[model samples]
Target: MFTSRAKIAQRLLRRLHGTNATPLAKRPARPSVTMGRALALGLGGAAGLLGSAMAVASLESDDAVFTNWSATHSCHPAKVYHPESLKELIDIVATHHAQQKKLRVMGSGVSPNGLGFSDDSILTMSAFDRILHVDAAKSQVTVESGVVVGDLLSHLRTHGLTLQNVASIREQSIAGVTQAGCHGTGAAIPPMEEQIVSMEILTPSQGLLTLDDPSDHRFQLAKCGLGGLGVVTKLTLQCVPMHKLLETTTLYTLSELKKVHASLLVENQHLRYMWLPYTDKIVVVTCKPYTDGSPIGSRISDDIEFRLEELRALYKQVATVPDPDHVNWRFTQLRDSLYALDPLNARYIARVNETEVSFWEKSQGSRVALSDDVIGFDCGGQQLVSEVAFPSANGSDLTFMEDLLARIERDQIPAHTPIEQRWTASSRAAMSPASSPLQEQVFSWVGIIYYLHEASPSLDAIKDAFVDYSKLFEDVMAPYGAAEHWAKLEFAPRSALERHVLKDRLRSRFPLEAYRTLRNEWDPHHILSNDFVDELCSTDL
Candidate 1:
């Protein structure tokens, strides 16, 4: 029952790698623009000085200058190559391998930690975005690495199929999500990397190899291998039958959350908690699959029209203060700060958080929507986020949450609202934070956020406060068997000892030496090695 969009897109992603491989003539390739004429997207930093340090403009000598979605990371590579065909990609890899050059493969550049940044030869997966095959009987679909998650979901909708789980955002590349081990909130669902039925990786030394069998050690390691062993060109993913979802957003007190936390996971198919800091408020979101229904309630609040006015008021207040040039009236975080009398004061921020609790109380309701539409939520503007995963206990990780909140309040930190906690079943990917040989174990992910609203005079000070807040949580969570999410692991500045300690901690949890040995076999010359992966391979520990 595959329609043209589903049949074609699914086939478009896989057919390019078949026995008689040929480029699809239906969809035209995305043409690259020359330097100085290409898009100059530069975001300096969540920190004031860091933002100004990035040179957003492209140089005449360079093919293109790149910055990540959050602007936390940027790079000016010597050359940027776009290979439209698999044969062309193989040739490029072979040449880079022969020269023993540092060639890094990139996706949508959405990683906040700047995983895609490279100073040497940079290759984009932009042109490889096609759905190559679909086997409805097996509930599987094949796609090229560059295919955006949003587009893939739209295609699958037509075929009455959808992914088992997806991250909160849809703008990222499929390969990036899988490699970074992104996840959705579900006690039974594993991280997104578990969707990979097989991946066709273009390795420097091995030419092309498919990691298909789950029992194979290579498949487990390379599934979330941090893109070291090879460049993943295409993958076959397991999909489920399409279904609608009923979502409800409800307000709760911190005590109430502790009481009902275990029951929430047992009752709902997907659940996430937003802990409003400095206030005794928590917002619990639950989504359950539904057979058929009309839209029931409004997820949108009645005061939506006044959101901009609240932002303008903050901008006006920020502009009149000392360091007048810092607040950008145009760049806003309406949900982040509705009313901040004093943006950095503990007592004043608590009032703002209380106002936010009121806002959620008003906005709380139930609604029915398609799974794809409901799963995607607005992540808001550029922000600095750090998330850690720990084994789930008694249905939730409230013990860790209560400890962290106590520390934040005791220190009077100017933390933001809605510090979140989400759950996922463990993954088979060897390096994943929730790594396990079995998928039955559940893990809880807790996150702290500091919104990077543009032009705030208090930006640097707020960032400093976050450092203390996060450090305390890290120290407390160590005994609970915690590990930072792969994508957000190295975002903070670390000293040599800190770096060595982090490396050692990672080695203790993951199969670092074994992975390193396998990587040496697949990419002996280290042509595909990037900074992140190189750090893991280092023996300095």
Candidate 2:
């Protein structure tokens, strides 16, 4: 009984070649007026000098900047510089850090958090994109930080190798993805960071230190160091032989889903389900190893997009669609298989509009792509987002999600988008948003996302609501020591940011103060302090 939405989405995904494939449509031309205005708005005269310097150094690779993604964080890097070699990257970091300029790294730019931005310099690992070496005997592959996941997977596929776990989107960089401990659905496997056998950290001073020896204790934690310890120049990853996955999708009510939670998780290799907030209908997907010659053909499907489009159409017709409760029931009753075939069938395929679009309509009942105008639906100029991660350790009682839905409705927040809750097993990374200092058990994570739709709200109002509501939900789960996802739009305040995180419990984890010691050890002249890191982390100006 997998509903049409989930099933069609899966089929559409197969045709899209795993999310990056372009839809069969023409590139809509930019409005001349919009283009002229944007060019006019560009910083000209003396300020334009910096912009020009960036353009000259940008990467020539099409795979260089994956713009299909959204900015999780607030800061927009003025320009993205793609370095082709370690020496060049080192020079870029050195020069920017020397000028006390803010520099942020770009890797597929998939996070919804503002952690990856600087108004001045954006560093791209595109040039560093290569499989430097592979030890078949050890089952490890060393790679530069800039390599794309799909590209990495395709290359590995040729040699019978794959990363341990990948997030829903395979467009993230190996460095950036693991930097925040990105993960997939699986009880036994930890987040992506666990797959790192070793890494080469390029500190402003320490040049490059090959971090290995998983038993070092600190090594495990530092694997997802959020580019804080230093820039990740090279990584030695543990890989498995490429294998096919058996996946099944089904629908259930929230009440019904609770009954089978244990059986679904304990009995399956990978399990994940999504329930539209305030709705009883749940879409459950389970994936496991499949070797039964399951029609070795492309398992593509476009039917999901058709179903999602149907859902969108339904939402449009309802006029008053904000009530999550109503949305849930109405969406469930709608036909699901109107677009898809039997879930067990092979040769699945379909297309979709994977591009992120805004809710705003241009003409009556018509919508336009956000990128068409460049400013992105005006998005009210800019917005901030905060995502908190809670553990499912207590059980998938639906209580956490249920409570969240109620609160948002009670407060009447302008939550225009569907709330997302993805699950990942606990991580062993020291600085990951999903780690607990005092506990050593695997925790099921529930990620809560709230987009600050408009900056018009009073700063105090926004901050208070974000902190208070989060604390309420977080406090209830704090006893379990739930961790947060690193790359989202919201982060814990300063005091709490230090307290709840292992970076404080395990000060030796990042050695921020000791990094000062290492800063002196490596670059005594203070020649390479990145302003983005300095300002964001509150290192002395």
Candidate 3:
């Protein structure tokens, strides 16, 4: 287990190396200058390269290293500045301000968006990752920016506390999660950032500023601020006591799935489901709070590696052989197990298996086959993705889903993958791609994936077709107000984003004008400006 500080430093190194043209050590450093004195010499943007080697040895703790989820990104920091304390963070920000380089705060490198990296400087709050204060009476905990969600949860468990909700993966940095406005399903709930009661912001002009009482309009707006406002050094999150989850999983026919949806929701504390498009069936997952003398269940011991290998075999068989549908059946049996069992029992199951049957067991992670090593395999490298969320304002309904599946089968689109469908309640965060005003709106998330028989095939010809299909689907879901996920491929043109979200409304909540004022007020030199944020805000999409 790596210390939080060490982990953060490693991630910085990875980020730096990932983008740099030359490998880190071989790259020449700027002319001689001290770390702090280097700033005085007017070397801001290029200083990160020099800072990388220095950061590796300066980690504050081992707990810090365990905080990072990906080893690939651990050694990429242009400069890893780990302040021994929060006070140091203020000085670092102020120093960068003087040097004319915008400073970016890194949480965990979970986002594909290049927001966390910059040519200037990067600051990691690994040293400050601790539970500063926990108020059990008020059900709140003040956490440093560098803390990982899983670590926090472990500590909270000891204190009989837990976050009201968490994302599928708990490896995210506390500061990073809030900065990106990560969220989960449910209408009664808000995004993770919404739980923040206050934040300690380390800004250029105002050092160690605290935004108290996030319920206030200013605080709420800044809670989801895309790190353009300032580096969040710490956060105060509202939490609830730990509780056992009683869950249930059931397969429903298309009509039954639609009919029982309401009862399932009203009867459970948490609900999510998956659908195999064109199959007329949906996997229903429902979880409720269990307060009885329920025993904690044991962790699963599934042969995940073997299963992944089998999946690769299935994909290969489907691609080269004629038993494509058989492969699909096998995969569904494995994937559906995530929601296949009754919540009240201690039962577990593999909800989905590449094989055609669903059985009891624990939640199984998504895995696809690797055809690279298979003998006689000729397809070039294939990319697999899971892109699902509420349909856009233009998506179709059950009929559309069924029709698409039938069409794929009829036309033999060459892309043979089962479309997984899941339903989610509305989201309150304005920036959420799936934002909706009606809390009870049920939106379906459909994923379309393709595996090829050749390497690096051109997707241009299929792009137009995908757009047409997405538009039709979006039109069907318009009344329900659906949206897409950020990281996945999108069919909605940049123009639709403008008209759909009412960019003016986003500007209002994000406080674009005020943020600009704050940016100018805090970072007068435009040190932190990046083409990514600029393009995102400026683009019609």
Best by lDDT: 1
For 1-541, candidate 1 gives per-residue lDDT tens digits of 1122323233323412112322233432332223332322322110000111112212232435566666567777776666667887888889889989988877666777777667887776655667888788998999988777877888888789999899986756788889888898888888999999999998998889998998898999899977788999999999999888899999888777777787887788889988988888888889998766565666645455343444445435544453343233222355443323344677767766765665577668877888888877777666777899988976449888888888889988767766889999999888888898666788999988777656455767766766777787788788888998887877347788888888888888889998899889999988777888888789985
Q: Give each model's whole-structure lDDT.
A: 0.72, 0.49, 0.48
TM-score order, best first, reads 1, 2, 3
- List TM-scores for all candidates, in order: 0.86, 0.64, 0.63
lDDT, ranked from best to worst: 1, 2, 3
- Residue 420 C-alpha lDDT in model 1: 88
Residue-by-residue lDDT tens digits, candidate 2, 488-508: 524346475544453432333
What lDDT is reached at residue 169 by model 1? 67
TM-score of 3: 0.63
Report the lDDT of model 2 for residue 300.
26
For candidate 1, report its TM-score: 0.86
* Strongest candidate by TM-score: 1
lDDT of 3: 0.48
lDDT of 3 by residue, 296-372 (tens): 35433355544345444434443444343534343333232211221111111111222322232223322111111
Give candidate 3 regions above 4 Å deviation: 1-80, 293-526, 539-541
